[model samples]
Target chain A: MKFSPLVDELIKSLQCLPGVGPRSAQRMAFHLLERDRNGGGKLGDSVSRAMSEVGHCQQCRTFTEQELCQICSNPKRTESGQLCVVESPADLLAIESAGQYSGQYFVLMGHLSPLDGIGPDDIGLDRLETTLSEGEWREIILATNPTVEGEATAQYIADIAHDCDVKVTRIAHGVPVGGELEYVDGTTLALSFSGRTAV
Target chain B: MKFSPLVDELIKSLQCLPGVGPRSAQRMAFHLLERDRNGGGKLGDSVSRAMSEVGHCQQCRTFTEQELCQICSNPKRTESGQLCVVESPADLLAIESAGQYSGQYFVLMGHLSPLDGIGPDDIGLDRLETTLSEGEWREIILATNPTVEGEATAQYIADIAHDCDVKVTRIAHGVPVGGELEYVDGTTLALSFSGRTAV
Candidate 1:
């Protein structure tokens, strides 16, 4: 039943991901050794690379490897005078994969839930306000999730953006009521995409 | 939505986990940044610890840190001549957590799936044969899973051990039909312990 410290450590480390229990973690550890030796090797390399290279963008709160995240730095993508605000990089990718919008983003890392003591300041709302005050974006899109906390966040952002010169908008109902975008089927997601009405 | 290369890379890297999709991966990346700033910082450190530190034991095929795994080196663990042979370290841990066994282990690392060309030699069966041939073991318990592939692998080991002078045994009855030991509750697993009948 005993294992080497590092091998044991590796198994424990894999458990940190959501839903992976001890057994799955053990399976994953062995999987790295068995089916995808190269993936295992690549996984180690990637973790180290992302850890050292990727960082936060001061201006937009999204993760970046350089002074700004690639989205904020690039000159080619249609900046379009629109800023889509999201709760995390994951949500950003969900929107990106749909291939709908051509605007930039502001990833809010956390949602505003006061019971958890996550307010505007806790979720970098003040920075979003200051950036909106500068009047760079034509329409500020609130793309937080449809959760209770997310709706509160959207309302909070709407109030702040409305005071600024920017046109306040909450990106509409592509996501289902009480449904996580992660669980939504691709077709439904696409339907939600086409049906997005103004907030 | 347009994103930076850093953003893209982070998402793909996180998707390496079993159940995590692209969206979940994105959320995880953001979750790490927001909630576990210290844990996030530690992730980079743990990646290298796991990567460089883990490797297969030269003797047993079980993962280990040193030249020998902790079990192989320990004096407290049974040197009592019984070897519970399993296909992976995960299996060994499952059996061990039941607090039932007082023997050492010989993990085959994989099963003998002939169609896949994973025969005796391919799955470290050769090493097991040599260990059995040495006549040091009192019994070799074939504790492979109850799945078809696992059954096939177990049969192959039983066949090889048939000619050996030592007693050969197989764990029985506690595991559900077509159920994985990973999913079985600990109490049932313990009951499986008391219920173990020989091959």
Candidate 2:
């Protein structure tokens, strides 16, 4: 609090951001003040500008300053068939970083949780249906995380998509690559044993 | 560019701040997207606001959103007749955390560096003279770091304040508590030996 008002406020404000403890916030505060005055200022400007400029792309929920995100606006991406579903923009980001998938994404901000009163409508399942109903989708890949709620959500969606002609599949979650048989957890080992294939 | 745009941009922006390397940037980026959404947003907002709103206080050069910093504006602090000069706001924060110094600060923002083309005017030495000339100051504590530039800066200020009736002093830097004598630098050991007092 003995710091300048701006310094104090900046440190305290950063404390609100997730995972940013008071000590880290103080370190950040010092960093901004001691170095990177221009870059830090530019980042602030960018954050506000991006916040105001970027909106969810009409087709996908990716962060974009324009009406369409760069990926959605690009003509190179496939116009039909492939669609990947994810839990949040963060997950979509992870997939994009891999650069392995060349398809579109549907982001559900949260997982379905009936216990928390979150129903199918709460996580964009209706939107998924509407998009599928457009008859543009071919293979719908459920790329949500391999957690309890994620599995349940995938199952529920798989049932609903069964009425349509689109081929529905959930992303596999088994033993990691190069993992030892002894190191694999019970769930993963069970999944691996059940999902085993011919040599 | 290999990272997601959001992650890449945030990481790049983070590099501008002091002490944040690739590791800290990655952690901070993940934190913003995942852990502390509200706090992260708040930190971003605070930074944006502070960068735009707060600037160097006209008198002491400390950052403040107002025309004057809180220390400058407060009547009680002014009456203390004490001015603690430091190289940066980080130093000011450190001293304040120590809670021993309740006096006002004159943050130089940078140390004296002739090779770097830095001069006294660049670091507010001229301003300090004007403030000292007002004859309100009693004690002046030179709290610069023990670096070469810091020592030189302190000596330079002491020279200028020679004629003033104020008591000028430099903080000692020698063997730290729990420091092994063998680990102490020869220079520090010399100072400790020379500055030794009779018990």
Candidate 3:
């Protein structure tokens, strides 16, 4: 579809969002232009403000305006001395929404991918090591995904925690909450059965 | 997930986009804060600039920074004296991308919805009447959607065009390209069969 240069640029810029495609971007651009200029203005201003103000937290590497994120800075959260290591801020937010985890978090920013040139230091693994050594953590939860890279990263961090005499635990992997057993994949079914607990 | 006030506001503001819910908004917010600050900044600036600069064309009611849209202002396009009336700017873009039509367009911005308090005047039908009266046109193409409201609007506009002794045509609605007859809905199948033409 043909758009003015300004509208064209806006549509292209919107594609940076995950899962948004060219058609969806066009729809968003027209929506902003036609019905919701006020909403568009607010979105623009908020995005700019967030981009400029947000930065990595000093302790956990999560996005925050201050040096430490809300979770890292809060004394109540730190009292648990239980830390969860995650692959990204989105994962951290997911755990937070579950409302079960009371401990603090350490975000890896990304999983290790040697082919992609991301190694030990690239995802702040060295910082993670230092944090493990310094903190008096009773246990460390490796909440990374169950992909091959996630497993490798978890193992590497587990070795580091072992060296520091800290306990390391991996979050369980199994069939998803709503998945039917018949429709579940073989690997997930096996993992769910093997990781089964007493009823 | 609990976010700082600024982050929360940004996520909330992002929900104005069509099909984006709270989860997608949160993901978008975190993405901007983490990986795509530059894109976020650019989108914000572009949205504001478009909102402030873009306005409806005086003649056709389509969006443009100038008093008249590119199509309306172009001397070559106006000479055809063929006007295509559409529901919104998106529909105009879709037709323009097809590159078959050389005529100009008039955007209604919305369909007539009586329950929602929208009427003929609300969608600039009066302005359309004025434009039709002033212009020397061969035909008026009613390019609104094929829904009930669309048919009503097209009939209403056709009545007006009839008064002006202007020929009115409705865009054909039939089986879509690549549509399988077995899978086609009853209404669409009926419409396609009824609108059939001899080869």
Candidate 4:
């Protein structure tokens, strides 16, 4: 037998999360019901509100409830004249957390996948081209994932930036810091060597 | 920078699940926002409804929107006269999935833990006692966990069942099936030996 109808429905609905499966969903449902009803209620309200209200920023396509996201609305960020392109908002946040860049971002939301019929327009490249042409960007940085699709997407965006007369660069591919060279993939090792710079 | 206000709030609220951390919560939030708004909306609605409407089953104390849980309300299950007591609804579901028990269940919601200030009433033991006294139960099956608190709870409930002139039995403790004896803990190995029956 299953949990009561409402409890069962809650469990099934929870499986929409990226990594959640049956057991995890059930545990989450029971945890909310038994221990943290207030938290659960808050979560429900927040999810509903976010789903209905959150929309893409007019400039960069990052998530926001406003017409323009906070970063896009900030004159200082816009004045930085450096645009970083990433595959998702999570990637944008990762770069922000590093505290290395102070530029505006254009979130692709996903890379171009020709096999899946995902093209330039699907990842908002048309908007990226328009921004590149309109903004006084000194440089465009591609920080998409290190995969075939990401490489193709970066190349495509780089061409667009070149046509707009803006310099473009891809984030370096190399053995990650704190990682052993022996454990690093051959392609990454080769790229590290090819892209090496003098100290 | 963090996500926009509503998206950020949604990520934080998603962390209320048992194993979800900041990273997992962010991933979940972005996933729902980008890919599955319908599922996320349904999750929110179900969670809100369940939080507001679901309550303890009056008869067995398991979670249910109705006065009695499905198992408690079913006449066929009630007629079995064997009441299995478990520490949580999850545990009750586990037993039901095993397809071994057909009797009604009494969910304790939690075992007795006095140091944490949880008492009999905190786990609905008063209601359990009332049901035990009022029903014509043939046997009371104690299926609480094997922890110290669980043992204490089972002993306490056993005394109550004894007062009602009902036979009480604790689920056996032993090395788990399919587990190597060499890897089994000494306590479990000893229990396996002590509880061994004639072959």
- Among these predicted structures, which one has the highest TM-score? 4
lDDT of 3 by residue, A25-52 (tens): 9899889998899999899888888888
Candidate 2 on A1-199: residue-level lDDT in tens?
4666667888887666445677777777767755656777877765444344444566666555456666666666657668888887668767887888887777776788999998999887887888888857779899988899998988888877786678998776788898898988999889878888789
B93-196: candidate 4 lDDT, tens digit per residue: 89999999999899999999999999999988888889889989999999999999999999999998998899999999998889998899999999989999
Alpha-carbon shift of residue B150 in model 4 (angstroms): 1.0
TM-score, chain B, model 4, is 0.97
- Native-referenced DockQ of model 3: 0.64
DockQ, all candidates in order? 0.35, 0.36, 0.64, 0.87
Q: After best superposition, candidate 2 residue A25: deviation in angstroms?
A: 3.3
List per-model TM-scores for chain B.
Answer: 0.82, 0.85, 0.94, 0.97
What is candidate 2's local distance difference test score?
Answer: 0.76
Candidate 4 chain A weakest ten by summed lDDT: A71-80
What tens digits encode model 1's per-residue C-alpha lDDT throughout B1-199? 5445655665676666566687677666656555554554455456556656667777677877678777777666556888888888777778888888877788888887878878788888888888788757778888987778888888888887886777888876577789998999887799798987689
Candidate 2 lDDT by residue in tens digits, B1-199? 1433554677677666556686666666655554455555666777877766767878778777777888778887878889999998767778878888888889898989999999999999999988887758888999998889999999988877776667888887778889999999999999888877789
What is the Cα-based lDDT of residue A46 in candidate 4? 96
Compare the candidates by DockQ and give the number of the best one. 4
Using TM-score as the measure, name the better of candidate 3 and candidate 4: 4
- Give the clashing residue pairs of candidate 1, or none: A70-B4, A71-B4, A90-B26
